[model samples]
Target: MNFRRFKIGYRTLKTAVGASIAMLIAMFLNLDYYSSAFILTVLCIQPTKRKSVRAVYSRIIASIIGVGFAFVFFEGISYHPLVFGLILILFIPTLVSLKFQDGFVSSVVILLHLFDSKELTWSLLWNEAQLMAVGFGVALLVNIYMPSIEKDLKSFRLEIESLYSKIFHEIAFYLRNGDSDWDGKELVEASEVIEKGKALAYQDVENHLNRRQNLYYLYFDMREQQFEIIERVLPKITALPVNISHCYIVADFMEELADHVHSGNTANKFISKLDEVKEEFAKMPLPKDHENFLAMAALYQFIEEMDQYLHIKRSFVGFNMKKKTASKES
Candidate 1:
């Protein structure tokens, strides 16, 4: 037993050391010596992995253009003076702001710096190109290996369910208590939290294409819908309160919807029930007071939208009866 324990501890230590070394190697690869890296870093902070690809590609293209321009302009200038520096300082930012940022644009500026020194040549441009290509390659490799957006779909389901539950409880609070004076801050807070969850979910889907590549595109598309829900209801979150028990009931169904998604147990009947709740919430009486009614209505609509979004998200997981049956039958 003592020998076995020693062996296990050695293996564990070896594995831990190996993992730490691998992580350090990854970080080293991501570091850069070029000014272009700064700009590329900015462009690369996309919410999705797909956008990372686009940003890197853009930077590569830009670098070539900028470098080529530098080469051409350097050959033409006779004297390196304050004039050359001043001219490019004003020109590059204009190009970046007006058009997409390109690394070649910066290369061109670098070329200008070399122009006055009269040391630039085709070889110099070639070296710069090599440097940029390496930087881009490093970025791509780092992102592919360790995407910041990766999350297990199952965990995302749990997070989203928790958010939906919170929203439901907030709605229930208003409905059961009929607190007209109760500001809708809780609902707003829930919306804010859901928005964060949506963003995180979308990002996770994007970064780990291997995990849920089929839903990657849908994740981005659905975020827009979720944001729309937030926007429509956010302004009402702080408004005068009204009786929204009915809305809370609908919100409860939305929480149930997330459960259905997780359990992979939602049937046509559940869907119909959801639809019924949605309809009831939609048709429920509103306050005669325009402000209170409108706020309540906004909250109701927001929950309805969430229900619709959840439905769409579930479709990817095949939560519908038709798909679930097919899955089960298979």
Candidate 2:
């Protein structure tokens, strides 16, 4: 059985439960057009808490404006087809201007209720308001306890770190041996991991209303910037016409870096070591031929790129410190 394909997601389960509860409550209260509550519940349910709350507020305001328009168009003029169409034309633009376009469908539902009645009364208005309250209220309650994606975010972090480590190791191997049979799969995999991590991190940000920034999101952003440097250096490293004595030193440094791939800020130490490498390169004998000269130039550029990569990591030191301080205070 391919039950995996048929598996219901949390959002789906929430929508069904919330809609049912809303409809039941409306029916219990003997509200007119009780089924409309189900529609609102289904519409109001959103993937994140902030979105759900925003949907509720938008719908409530739009529905109120819709009722006002209904009163003016239906009662003030007449309950006719032309008047209904006129209300839609004016109402849609008004909602769009107010940035309540998300609530258009809910407002239309309210308009239809008035259209069907042929007349607006206090009792009917109260019934629709209660329906909105029941439906949107149930949606809000169901969405209050969103399942945390912390575990998924953590998994992505570990995967990105692992891919980065593999990439660094491969670069080191190429530098040391002057050639490799490597298919460059790690570069592609690391890019994909960082992208996926960023998406999940952004989703995590959307799930929390109070969160102005997510540490995981910032971490993925930093990695993405670092990955771009890695991509630029890979070709430069591989295209070297000849490997100099300095290549082995750089390879050793890369190997140490690969082994220490972690979430901590240790890039300053590597930056110091890189400065020492640069001094050693300056002291070494000049390239003997144009080919060796080109190779040394490429290696120098590679070193510059590596410096930029480490600097990117180093920049996160202040960010992490602030995050730690906030954590302790909280």
Candidate 3:
């Protein structure tokens, strides 16, 4: 058996522990329908702390509202089957209107308890409230310490940068030699890495209640934008009709850019070097034939795209600062 494939994730472990604790506490309190606490804990456990907190809050509020509806319909009117069905019709909408739909299942559980007991006594209400507190409270407590995904985020960042480096190097090689055996696998790999990185970064953002933005997320987003530009210009670079002096110039710049593909903010210097290349290209004589003219145009468009790519990196504020902070932390 491949036990490695069955490796439990942190969130799963937390959910299990939380559910166990919630059930034990509910049982200790002698709450009726104590097993429901286990279900509540499982339902309330979320991947991110903010989500878990929100889930708990919603479930608590929804349970309270459920109790209220039960009191009005069952106690004031009658605990008949028609009244039960009617209460559900109105209860669901009320929870939805209050934005507590996440708690619908847990609230329904409470309603079932009331229906089973066939009573709206004060003791039963207190028992249900205690169950909610134990279940959701345990879930909230368990989720308070979300394991940091910083290491995974950093690994993805490094993988993306390495892939980008290889891609740029391949482009430079093709531009210089007018032929490359490169299979362009790095392009696809980089795309996948960027997508995964963005997802992980977004999860990190959700992990923190107060954090509005994650720097790693912004970094991946910037890289995604740059990757699009790279994809756009790749065919243009490869399909140049003739290898000219300007192509070599751009190739050399690309090699230099490849070497500097770290999490640093050095795009400004490259942009300056690129401008020099542009000036050099301008001084060359006009292309002598249509093929050469098309080649020159393609090279020019490639340079413009490279400029956009560098500008995207430059516009990513605080990237270098975050890099430094990460370095110090390491």
Candidate 4:
């Protein structure tokens, strides 16, 4: 069995290895305060690559600023309670103004070193820089070996498609038989699955430098929008008193649509197909009976919902295509 499928595998193991390596490197170099390297590595490991990069950027800057401020404050002013308070007042505002607040906690750690050492010397400052470099650098290198997310992305896509297929099939069955076995729980499951899938896709984006838009993210978003319409469609399906002629028509259409959920069919083609259905229905006589009228009304509402779902799906495709074309041209 693939052990990495568990939560405590590759990522956590890599983090531990990275921290150990950082400390080893620091010891080999004979740097003072070598444990700082291990500490920094632990703090730097993040859920997404983008977050790790941001953390490193802000912390490095914050550490440098911290060292400089502490050196000046300790040497130029008396190291009294009032002086420390004054330094914090100035330093906190400076970090906020520079938009480096993400590093505030790290900066405090940097300040603590100055407080304990009481030696404002170049040698001590160099040690701080060395630890930050070795720690963050090792962490970055280890994180770069991220496993291929393509497989996971495809898995999520298939899951979402399956959910959509089930929903459509259920709708078709309901229209055809005037009864449905579907518990409507797939709607909830689909929402949860899409949201989780989107989060993973975002992490994939963070792993790449040149990634503009993740197709899986777009795919999940399209599914999520359609999910809302599906919610509306189900109620209308259940509200009709009895099956009408249009109900059979819609049942057949939904069944056909379910077969093509993962077919990569163009949204425009579906839109065109819907136009034909609308036109064909327009040529028929209006419903004469109260039961037929109710069923026809529900069928019309269902068609509108399906049309909206298709359009939303189309919007993602069209927008992403234009983006890719522009990227290629540039």
lDDT of 1 by residue, 206-297 (tens): 66656664343343344345545645554444352654455467546644544443343544545567677767766767576776677566
TM-score per prediction, in order, is 0.52, 0.92, 0.92, 0.87
- Ordered by TM-score, highest first, the candidates read 2, 3, 4, 1
Between prediction 1 and prediction 3, the one with superior lDDT is 3
Q: Estimate, for each residue in 92-168, the C-alpha lDDT of model 3 and write its tens digit.
A: 99988989999899998999999889877889888988888888899989988977899999999889889988999
lDDT of 2: 0.88
Higher-lDDT candidate of 3 and 4: 3
Candidate 2 lDDT, 1-330, residue by residue in tens = 454556889999999999999999999999999999999999999998888999999999999999999999899999999999999999999999999999999989999999999989998999999999999999999998988888988888788878888888988999989889989888888888888888888877878899977888888888889889988999999899887888898898888888877755377778888899899999999999999999899989998998998888776633346555321100
Screening candidate 2 with a backbone cut-off below 3 angstroms (N, C-alpha, C), the clashing residue pairs are none
Query: Residue 19 CA error for candidate 1 (Å)?
Result: 20
In terms of lDDT, model 4 sits at 0.81
What TM-score should be assigned to candidate 3?
A: 0.92
Which ranking of candidates, highest lDDT first?
A: 3, 2, 4, 1
Q: What is the lDDT, from 0 to 100, of the residue 85 in candidate 4?
A: 82
CA lDDT of every candidate = 0.51, 0.88, 0.88, 0.81
Better of 1 and 2 by TM-score: 2
lDDT, candidate 2, residue 329?
5
